[model samples]
Target: MPDLATFQREMRKAMVAGGVPSTTLEGAVVSDTLPAERRIRVHQNNYRESLCRALMSLFPVARVFVGEQFIKGVFAKYIAREPPCEAVLSHYGAGLPDFLAEFAPVCQVPYLRDIIRLEWAIHSLQLVEEFGNALSADGTPRLSPNVRLVDSDYPILNLWMAGTGQIPPEAVSLKAGGQCALVTLSGGEVRLAALDSAQRQTALRIEAGEPVEGDSLTMLTEMGAVDFHAG
Candidate 1:
């Protein structure tokens, strides 16, 4: 009899490589509704499709740029190359922005990479807002986990807003793509506020959990953006 590890090994092979690892599994499956290979393909498709939908949900801006058919094809290859690790589903495609940056097929669509980065930042922040408060006790200034900088050499935030219909599509000029911003959720609202160079660095440092102080932090607090003080 095959051990559990052996069975799992074969299952992985079937799901990923599309073939039986052993004759044992081949003979063991008693399917009345479909052939064994067909059944295995169904399982594989379901697993990949679930992850595909999750990726699109996380990076809707990227989805708009590539369109459904194109994005589906892109993710089919991405899923093959970067299978999810033992993490939550929301974190599965954390490396996708990096993946798309180097993906040869998407090289012409450079904006797609930056858009992926910005969308990933928003998705991550939204998840944090959904799950954690991360505010400081007392009246000390602090930022929730949802606050983070999205630095891009493209107008990725505009593209996102336009794609989501929050702004007119023509309001964002694809030819003039360059901006940076801080993404956060406030009172159940997702906001992407523009940022300057120093402000961008400050946001990055704060998100890194560094104890930030100085002009940038002072300005942010003065602007009422960094005051999480309960009082």
Candidate 2:
């Protein structure tokens, strides 16, 4: 018989990988009378279900765009290709934006990937801000509770706002061009604000792993940032 630690590790692998049972323990091992394979099936279903729920919560607008079947397919592929590495399941769908970019089926809907990226940012910001009490001086919050920065060639703000019922229904024309937005939590509420040229430049600099401070803002302004705000 394998030791307890080995048994647990093997069980976890079998549960996630969907293969023949490796342990000798019967159905009694998993609190079910079904055969080991069936029990494993249940585990598989549970795992996929949990992941789907997480994705849905993070990207409801994306879900609406792709519909149910396509989303299920995406979730299935995501689980098989990129299983959760960290204990926190919120981080599981972080790769979804890149996946959508490469996914051939949704290539025509280019804005879809950017929309998912925005949603993921919001989800992550909410989780992080909830845990840390980081605050700026004079009681002014430094990082918004939800960090939703949009860096896309597509009009993600319009699509997201339309999906969430913030924009009028008739205003959401498919032909609308691309735009960038920043979703942040201000005064304990989530707010989606449009990003100006300067902010976009700053975001680009920060995303490139460059330090964004005084000189960076100056460079951004020189690079054609019409209306720069000091935040």
Candidate 3:
């Protein structure tokens, strides 16, 4: 008989794909009505469908951007290669953004990777209870626990807005150049703010714990996006 670890590894493979070794399948508790092979298939189907749904929920905008059929096919391919590492379903598709960077089908849609990244950033922040203190000791504003930075060479913000029905699809221009954004969670809702080059630099500086001075900092403070510390 295979060791426990070997048996578990084989079982995992069986759950992911067919071709379960007869020796392994024989260990299943067989009943008169259902055989072990058929039982494993039922579990495999549910496992695959659940993970696929998790990926779809993680990147709803991406699904809208690429149509249900395309996204489903792409995700099905991804699921076959990568399995869940942990129990948390929300965190399952973290690597998908990088996966898309190399996925051949999306080669023409270069921005899809960044869109997944943006969505992942938002999804990740929702799991955090808090980022950190409100401000640095020196009075420089600091990024909130909920703030996430995403910089993309494509007009991903417009694309995301369009995908979410916030704007008309015609409003997005892929040739409009790159865009940067600060994604934050406010009052339990995710918010996106587009930033110019200078503003992006300022935000980056703050993230690095460097002292920064600018109208962007001041405005963010006024908007309660960042808290100002009195020196």
RMSD of 2: 6.1
Give candidates' CA RMSD values in order: 4.1, 6.1, 2.9
Q: Which one wins by TM-score: 1 or 3?
A: 3
Give the best candidate by TM-score: 3
Cα lDDT of model 2 by residue, 77-169, tens digit: 777777888878777898987777778888766778888888887777666643233333443212333455677776778888887888875
Off by over 4 Å in 1: 19-24, 31-34, 129-144, 201-217, 222-231
Clashes of each: 0, 2, 1
Error of 1 at 162 (Å): 1.7
Best-performing candidate as measured by lDDT: 3
lDDT of 1: 0.72
Candidate order by TM-score, decreasing, is 3, 1, 2
User: What does candidate 1's lDDT look like per residue over 141-176, in tens digits?
Assistant: 565554656677777778878878899988998687
How many backbone clashes are present in model 3? Answer: 1
Better of 1 and 3 by lDDT: 3
- Ordering by lDDT: 3, 1, 2
